[model samples]
Target: MNRPADKPLYAVQDIPGKGKGLVATAKIIKGTRILSEQAAIALPFGLPDKERRKIISQQLKTLNNDARNAFLSLQNRFPTKSQYVGIFNTNSLCIKTSTDEGSFVDQAAIFLIASLINHNCENNAQQSWNNNTRRHNIHALRDIQEGEEITLSYVFSLLDRAGRQALLKKSFNFTCSCRLCSLPIRESQRRDGNVQRVAALDEVAKHQRSTAPLQSLQCYHCVLAYHLSKYGREDCEYAQAHGDVATLLVMYGDLARGRYFAQKAASVFRTLLGSDSNEAAEFAAMARDPSRHPQYGFSMKWKTSVDEIPYGLGSADLENWRWERLIPEGIAPFADIPSKEHFVKGGTSKKRHWCFMGEIVKTKLLHPVQLEVKDSGDKKLALHFYSSNTSDTGNSLRPGQYQKGYTVVILDALQYRFEFGCGINQEDLRMMKIFPLRLAKILALNKEVREFSIRHDDGKRKCHGCGAKAAVASMKRCSLCLSFWYCSKECQTAAWTTKAHKTDCKSLRDPDLRGLFFYNWDEAQDSISFPLQVADDSC
Candidate 1:
């Protein structure tokens, strides 16, 4: 059916410092397609300069008079021997082409209108190549006001201000003074550090994706959080992280959350890449039917259908469910320390971290310190500390924290085969924690916290002070840990004094301890470590 023509979305106009660039003529809502056009010239990456010039010349000649004028009008950042070749080189955008065998290769193409959209470090518009339509589409990532410059990011500008300035000058032949690049010195340095940290996290996710998909998934979630904190979540990278997390969740048989993230991905893709783009369609389908994904059922441990999505949840509770929240205490003794075989075969376990508790039966202080510790099962094992942190040892533990029967909690615990017997090769001081209490007592408290601290459907809450089950509201919650409850001042005083709640409360206040319990163990957000900055009671 034929329809009335819509008004043009944008117009090419003079941008003070940017010369001629696209500017929004009318209000463009987020996710609305600003432009969708085919390339005038295309060339595969890694072609010889001579061959590239020849290709550009051929494609340029085939264009109509008006198209040729628009193509030639594009900025030539690098003025080559041939102006046509220079124009193609400067204006070309990356377009990925895949083989029949499902392998992808990079190709660069020049689009008439898209080539005129100027660069911005924090662009309101996103550019994408439509795999199905074989066209370049520009979509408003965020709502663009009429008369606002319609810009797209020219580079992955996760670089420091100096680096960004240098790169833009060298490659794009212009100095960028975008908001990010124009920040104050101190703020710029802080932003640069976050940039480096995000880059490092991305590398970690890539490396751990195969060996530790759970860890990789957590890292991707961390990336999403970083995106939320620094750049807004509407960024291209942030949208991609949503898809990455979705894929991992699906592989782990978490269809409920996988579909949720897929839905988020689909929404962002629709807004950033247009609904007709391959990315949007692919995620839309996955959100509708996650079981259709190639990696579906890779592991059924977290098996749940899309219908399992919780209803009537508040935003905070929804986030906790969305990011698989971990109960540090509950995970403590679920599995034995991983042996060398497990690590070598690639950690097939969904968890990237675990806690190993063992009581100190013997101690040997030397270059490579050794400690004989006993676990809950009364099984004794030798722990050899080959850690680079020489200052932190059993003696270095808090005055009363280390004792004969005191147990050490090692996060990301691993087992090794020593000449004497199978034991732990202690490394990374941050991962090791020496509780003043015995392993049995520590575990008992862990059990208590799991049962009593949390609210039940029946409104019953266990008083940390008296161990008495009471109405949830009748109990006074512990100021710290945010996990323990108390009955009355009388019970609270008695528990704090007589019931050993004093020492337990102190331990509960430890960020590292709280970090363990609240950290997402399933498909969650935020990858935590020691010196943890944990959020106050997420649930």
Candidate 2:
């Protein structure tokens, strides 16, 4: 493996508008550490400014001639303050340092040569704090060509152009003309929308991590997917997210997936931070024995040993398994289901849920029942139904469900190469349902009810009408759906007329639609049939 060279890979050079910046002197491949140097001066990050200034002044006096000169020469945005203190504040980097097992603290430090690197919204370099080595390491996030200005992101959050500009101006006292920031208005807004959605998903993960583990995992999985599409899983952020998924999986008692994610996290960390990094070594251990995690068995919902991992699964199936992306927490939109060519790659089916849904456009009741359906993507496919082992009559589906514009849903469905056309070969009547509404309308109802439905947390539920929190008995449920809640007759009327609860109430009347909101799809269990037994508390 090509690793960081012993010699410096960059040279401190003067750029046109940006003062002094680190310019790559040699081709730096992604994951190669360009620099790994101990901090010249380190201090706790959030100390009182006066106290920090005094400490910096003291540290300056302790440094030798060359080191002292280097620290003083760095830019001082706050020129009005003491020279050493101002320089420290202007160029300090926040790093994580571990004091003991499973405990870490953030500190501020200054790197003489590293601090000179310029900032960019779309930076090609990444900076990491190596707790084991007690050094700050700069790694190439992407391949860097010789003579390219090696840059790191000063604003790490998914902030838009204006937000990045404001932060850059406030902290670093410079305007960023980076490629992403310099994009046209319409193009920048489009990029910002995508980034903001990722950030929102992260916030959802943080809020639901403890209260709703499955929901939190869904958000993290979406965030990871976004990173994979944008960064191709090579960046530091990707490794951190992978490690987080591993930890969550172990906590949920899914040792099979926990071990897989842990192993991947370790590999990524080894590439970016080296095999010697604390992160790499810790994850490597977890991969070897997932049951050893501190949070293991918090919930045995997904209980399984590492040996339970399915063999011969294709890439898509493994990814679907990793994130639990189908059924329960994540409902696959019709367009996202695998095509026949992609799904027929041959794999051993694992113990997990798979759901496929679409709007019925045509139906055939010949030898085998079949339907032509259109998905959210507006793409059409055929569904050929086979007699299932179960003797149930699909919850006694009415004649309305057989008509055009009705929606059909199948669970644990497998893609098949049919003689007529490519589509799903659905068996198992217990895992399917046909609703009396357009696929688009039913999916919309799912989204709405998911967001506005009252929560069971702490005995207080939010009234979908007036947004007031009250105990269950104190609220009134929409008689049709038994889902939405209200505080008063007036609020209920407003929700029905203005808030458009009328349409939502109609679709949610179908018990299966409501059950989708309450099912624990993340729990590893036997395939279940509808009408799904929903808890009264789910309302």
Candidate 3:
């Protein structure tokens, strides 16, 4: 086989521990189109072995002498009765085409040079079918040095190291020795965990059509973070994740951020799949006017014009504004409480302080202690306590504490899917607390915290007592809740007595309640305790 006159970037060569592979002959810049070639043979997909072999033989007769030689030279690890069929199976790449009935059909085609590229879990190049040109195009995902092997990932999705090894060995009859597969066990496991979490978040995004806009946007942000942390900017999944987030933001009427993310997604797609790809063209247009999208305006909760984006922000502030990730000042970092509806089984654990605040309607101690309770949302759910000692279930509370109107707080609670109903399973003694206040009073206090107590770095901090912005550290925080700031002791006392803080201060004094504000909820790097100072400097 001979290389075409225009194809001078790479050449076919014998690779170590592998058969014939493509090796770069000259430096290839990122986003460069390295190879574009028509298939030497094509056959219908899903055909029986006998029928496919007959078709392959017929196509083989029509190939020119050079093309026929190249097809015959391709690798065939699984040899069978029909040599032509085995060669086709080993070298053919699946391509989408239309059938005579005007419906889509997947067809397998053998490309002489494209098939010669080897497999790598962390591939430096990507391949796609260019339907407009009726050929396969390979683009450099990153700059490829001369003498380096041209590679692409054979698997559709990334998997753990062990899973990748098993899948490659079973399907391709070879083990992958890529960069990711050769990492230390601990580092490899961390990367695998990130990928798995992102995959879970992807499933959540798919089912979030009926979910609230803010909640869906949160899920998409979490997915994007996982992808960037694991695969960095070069991975194709990173771009796709941004696209998912952009779509959700646009749907919820966040036009400024939506267009920003859409443009980022379009840039990456242009690099990986070429500017002519449908994904690149579609996202490029969406970035120009996000409101034009079909799914745009599902909710107007975050409505903003495309030109309303902030300017002149520092790099860190720019990212915070772009993602809406600015931690509200004064409101405890991990303690931005979430509802039970946000939970998903086998999904990523909650990284912020969330409690199931419910009134105990009834109680039973049969085998495992159970309580029938109604949450802040007025939805009833069961709370099951599964401690080794039954005494630990109530946390030393008297029978009077289990009254129908008494509020029970379970910290960092998750949604437990039970045969009877979906509820919460209280496991840790320290994670649960009982408050004398009713559920309504507690929620009202929480609303106050969200509005007046939370701080923002826009050079403003509203005094909880006087409702005035203080300069720097001139204000003092209420020592109990550490929630509200005051300009003076007199103001604090007047507000505490007159502003309903008198009722909320006692409930906030509980160690568990204070811990919720201080604890690091994103991920546990180390054990934590009460009177939580910023251990990770995350705040």
Each prediction's total of clashing residue pairs, residues at least 3 apart in sequence or on different chains, is 4, 1, 3
How far residue 400's Cα lies from its native spot in candidate 2, in Å, is 8.6
> Whole-model lDDT, candidate 3?
0.71
lDDT of 3 by residue, 1-539 (tens): 11123657998899988898999998888888888788888877678889988888888899889988988888887675478877787777777766677676778888988988888887889887766667787888899999999998877554777888897776666777777888988998878876776677677776774574554555666666655553544567778878887888888788998898999999988888888776788899999999999999988767889998888866654565675522222222122333234332231232234345787787866455678888756777787877766665444445655666777776556566576766777766566666676778766766666556656667556787878777637888788766777888988988888897887777777655545544445542333322344432221
Tens-digit lDDT track for model 2 on 468-539? 788878878788788888888988999999878887787678788888765655565554677777687756
Best by lDDT: 2
- For each candidate, give its TM-score against the true structure: 0.64, 0.64, 0.65
How does residue 286 of candidate 2 score in lDDT? 96
Name the lDDT of candidate 1. 0.73
Q: Write the per-residue lDDT of candidate 1 for residues 43-148, one digit (tens) a residue.
A: 8998878898888888878989999888877778787447876777777788997778888889998888888888888888888887666878888878889999
RMSD of each: 13.7, 14.9, 10.8
Which candidate, 1 or 2, has the higher TM-score?
1
Backbone steric clashes in candidate 2, count: 1
The CA lDDT of each predicted structure is: 0.73, 0.76, 0.71
Q: Candidate 3: list runs displaced more than 4 Å.
A: 1-7, 98-103, 230-233, 325-440, 445-539
Model 2's alpha-carbon lDDT is 0.76
Which TM-score value belongs to model 1? 0.64
